[model samples]
Target: MIGSPITPQGVIERKRGIGKVEVEVKNMQSDKDREEDMDRLSDLPDFVLLHIMKFMSMKHAVQTCVLSKRWKELWKRLTNLALHSSDFADLAHFSKFLSWVLSNRDSSISLHSLDLRRKGCIDHELLDMIMGYAVSHDVQQLAIEVNLNVKFGFKLHPSIFSCKSLTFLKLSIWAVPWMTELPSSLPLPALKSLHLEHVTLTAGEGDCAEPFSTCHVLNTLVLDRCNLHHGAKFLCICNSNLSSLTIGSTTQETPYKFVLSTPNLRSLSVMRDPIHQLSACDLSFLEQVNIDVEAYFNAHFQRTHLALISLLQVLADYVKTMILSSSTLKILNGLSTSGSMITQIPCFVQLKSLKLKMKSSSSISDEGVSRIVEYLLKKCPLAKVDVINCRE
Candidate 1:
């Protein structure tokens, strides 16, 4: 046997044996690399991978399946889901996709944020169902933008108002006939920031009292283009912890007096709304005030001018920064230079910076502008006055 000559059959079999051994070795190496990739892909932990997937669109997350078997089902456990109806061609497909995603996603994983921007007309029931599901699972940041031109929006469900986990809430509506039912008692214990735009508050004579009175931790509040209820006597905000407030309720039909009692408010802005009356209490900590009153007071500038000056007189001593419209200064200048009775400009003891926001087509003469500046320099000798034309 030792000296037997090798035949063709034996040679062929020997060559095939070598090839099989080589293939087995290569296969073992490939299996080891795949195992490592499945476990420690780029040294990233599973939670890190999931955090990355949360930022990606659902479709892109699903496509990560092609990467490897480990990533096949990772998208189903994403913690953040931001969906918009505008991305879909029609309602049917959009509904189908959202339904599938919500139903198939892992139920145990709590949602961190859910941003749903619906531009099309949608059923209120569907919205409630989505919101209900989110609130039940401890959603932290919720932003619902329902900018519909149709007349089909309903009052928000109570669960949304009393959610204990929401930290940031923004609700924006365009022309939708939205009847906002502000819960007389909102239990947003964890809410820190709230923003509402173009929303209509329901009619209630003190019926909507203490809407945000329970929000102990709220710091920033914004209301833009919000129409007050006919019976709403006063929009009172008495948050001791509040720091910034921006009110832009310019609607004239329903005039509700603004009664703010924020002791810690630092920056305050009131624009657009020719607010009928304002009563602010304990603003000893206020540092900035920006008031832009255009159409409402311009109708009867004489009366409104005197009223604005009175309000400024009370705030001129405390505020460090003031951003007022040019028209306001012109009116104030009128009051100061009139021959009948020269009104006194309040001394801005603490005012350090003055910014005048005007239109490009400002009709106020250079002399008029100089008079206001000279008046400010005379009163606040150390103040820096600047002009800014904010017209496009």
Candidate 2:
């Protein structure tokens, strides 16, 4: 009987059982290897994990808590929390979640930055409370964006401005009117950068003072789509350390003037509505200047275009790089000496690089090119020219 069990079919069945055992062994080895790798990752230092977590969004980083017992509490130690809730369907749920996280933050937490943006309406009280918590923790950077159809006022808590560790702040609003005016003097002693978008500064009938008088350490400032009305004269009272500045215009019809005295400014960019005129007092230290002239069908007076040319002429002696676009090129081209009238090209003695942008490629005709070449030769003999079509 033992000799009879050595048939071909019996041998084949024995080999199939051996193959199944080998497959199970290989899978066990793979699972063991994976477990060891996970254990090594869990043993990584807290600081290394925190650095890795910084690259992930707050939601995804928090989800790592479910990875293992060691990771359960590590996400709470992250100092930089950025929560973007653009797809949130319920505003109340979002508000509650924010409140819970902020309230549960540890007292010893040294948060460096906090950014929260939601597409739906946000409760104003919750926003102020969150800002207050950040200030108390000495947050260095804060950014907040909200979307709502209601108009509400915001009061910059004194604690927020007084945080000595704060350096950067950005605020964006949608359809929300800031009913309260920011204090004339912000207490951000260490603040060096500020950005305000879609904000309105409502100065009273006689309030002509500067709004950022206390931001003395500011070196970079950007304002976009902001409305400055009520005879508000924006004056840089003491930005001696300022190196960069950008100002954009909104749809307001009122003509406003900005008085900047940044003696150490190295870069300046200005975009104004064609309807409103702009005049800069002194840009003597400017190394780079960009003047953008937006066309307006109703306000085609071209006074602002002319004023900008005159302003550039004043700064030509100091600027090393210059950029002109839209109506600005047209104005410069109009200074051609073709007619019977005498025309003089404003000379830029120090300009080394010049960039010109036109609305259409055809805008740079033969006459326009010749006039520009002649003007540049007269202004800066060693300058190089670069032409770009914005429409392209």
Candidate 3:
């Protein structure tokens, strides 16, 4: 009993005279603890709070208004607006919410970015409205991805291409639908990066024109699984300022050509299937190249083989870094075994790095691969080579 612990209340019962001071000290400690537990999030500056909400959906950001009076109108000043269809109960609910937010949000501040993703069917008109709003607000970056259950012929608002403030724009439409043919005039002077997925670029009746020719400052372009329809035999990408370019598979298995006017292109990638032909004026500045084209060794084998060789030869002069896919190597190996070995494999003059991507499914013998490797090594004596087996 002599070594007992003393509780705050127990001290009041044992020594009534000194209990007053102990009570005051205990009350002061409780107040300090309460002060530490007070809401510190509400004390953050408006810009800092808006940044924290940038990663949240527009619905969630708006819901934060109910937290306190300080947060009531903070969402209005958000620079980045992210809206997803799944955040609402239905399309109607999403549309109504979007309309209200666009109309009621503070318009004095320029939008930094606008990201809209829709899973199901989205009304093209609704997307157009959003694009119009983004352009008017001087949105610097705009990305819209729509994965539809059914095909949608979605065409962007015309104002988007004229927005001089936009620097980055990406429009991707899944479900194998084509966007209406790109308008012939694309005058995005400030746009530097553009990515289009599953879009179809059609020809103008009997003439051919460059869709991105007017984008003078555009430097990077990616066309993923974009097809050329309406009698368009080839895809023409004539952008002088382009430095990075990627051409994904087209819809045709026939030998479709790419008329590239990228003189200053430094990096290039062609995925999925081989482009039958590549026409370039001058690739003296080309430095990095990645060719990952696949084709069955059927009747089309000869064409595919020739196309790849032609591309390599075109790049052999100035390319410093090069990567060849497993399929491409397999095709080249077939040429060696069939007694059609190229008499003169183009010697890489500036070749510094050479990578050969091999697949286990490649039935080519080790000796056959070695012959090809030896041929490359002999041609490019100063190159560092790596043989990587990227098995499927």
Candidate 4:
């Protein structure tokens, strides 16, 4: 063909053949590319593979040993280890497994987090050892959930409160959940987040703020279903760095007085069964609040319907941007069954926006809302009020 004389027909046939070959070559290349894409996960770098393994439980990670030698020891260097009781056959087996796994893990690697949840007979001593080990290993975040069946609660090891490396901690000690031996002075120097559930909290003779005295970097604190020890029914937090506070009580007659001394608090959320009263909120720096009193209207507590009138008064004192549910408006009505003194409804000086979550059964008409808006306008002339349907 290269030596042949030039002709239109020859040239045309030669060009068509070349085009057909080129299309076939492209088809073959695409097919090969698809196969390469299918094998993508295997070709990923080791660090990416290790990152993916962190999401799986330690048990699952161990099972990956069957896949290849590269994965057999990858879990030993995992930054997070979560060991649950259900994963093992029995408590004894679980204990043995924990010992083996921890011992076999690379001691040179520092742990970022440790989660332990086991419900069984009281084994505070064993737990103390395990938790102590975690602290010594430079664990930054620790979560412990257990059941202490004894009449009295177990006091945690002092190492936990004094741990300078911890940034987050969650303790859910159930049954006998009182922490009797918290240090007179808690010193979580680096703690940024804390959550306590099902724990009985007692105040100490030392400064009421001692328990949180040294948490200079704390940003969030959650107290859920916490029982207060008699004579110590006050939660006094004085952290300057605290920005978010959430308190939830599932029972009536909550004895605790939430004394918020956090001048930098950005948001506050209260979900109460029937919080009789709250200390005057100092909201010079507050920005948002969500108060859910729907639980207070339960029929079991309805008969005693204190109407949460006092609570409403306390909320109006410092609430900033507020979300008002229909039930809240009902309680704020002057003609409510309890005859709340709506005349005492002070203007929200800090509140810039008021959101009305209205229900179809709401007793307040648009006219009533306008009147309330007018009253608030006296204080916040530029206040923004939005009446939104409950469906929204």
Give the higher-TM-score candidate: 3 or 4: 3
lDDT against the true structure, per candidate, is: 0.75, 0.71, 0.80, 0.71
Show the lowest summed lDDT stretch of 10 residues, model 1: 201-210
Model 3 residue runs over 4 Å out of place are 1-39, 86-93, 147-154, 174-178, 253-255, 296-303, 341-345, 357-368, 388-392
Higher-ranked by TM-score: 1 or 4? 1
- The most accurate candidate by lDDT is 3
lDDT leaderboard ranking = 3, 1, 4, 2
How many Å off is the CA of 278 in candidate 1?
1.3
Model 4 vs. true fold: TM: 0.75
Task: Write one digit per residue (lDDT tens) for candidate 1, span 185-230.
Answer: 6679999999988766553345343466689999999988776655
lDDT of 1: 0.75
Model 2 stretches astray by more than 4 angstroms: 1-15, 148-154, 175-180, 202-207, 272-282, 296-304, 325-345, 357-370, 387-392
TM-scores for every candidate against the unseen true structure: 0.77, 0.84, 0.82, 0.75
**Residue by residue across 1-392, what tens digits does model 2's lDDT show?**
35664889988999999999999999999999999998889889999999999888877787898988888888888899887784345777667777766766566888899998987767767777888889888899998786545555555555775778889988776555443335555668888898877766655346454566577788888877766645675433346778898877664666555666678888988776533344455667788888876555535435554556556656767888988775666555655534631143467888888887667644546577667656755757788888777874
Model 4 is weakest, by summed lDDT over 10 consecutive residues, at 300-309
Model 2 scores a C-alpha lDDT of 0.71
For TM-score, the strongest prediction is 2
The model with the greater TM-score, 2 or 4, is 2
Residue 184 C-alpha lDDT in model 1: 54
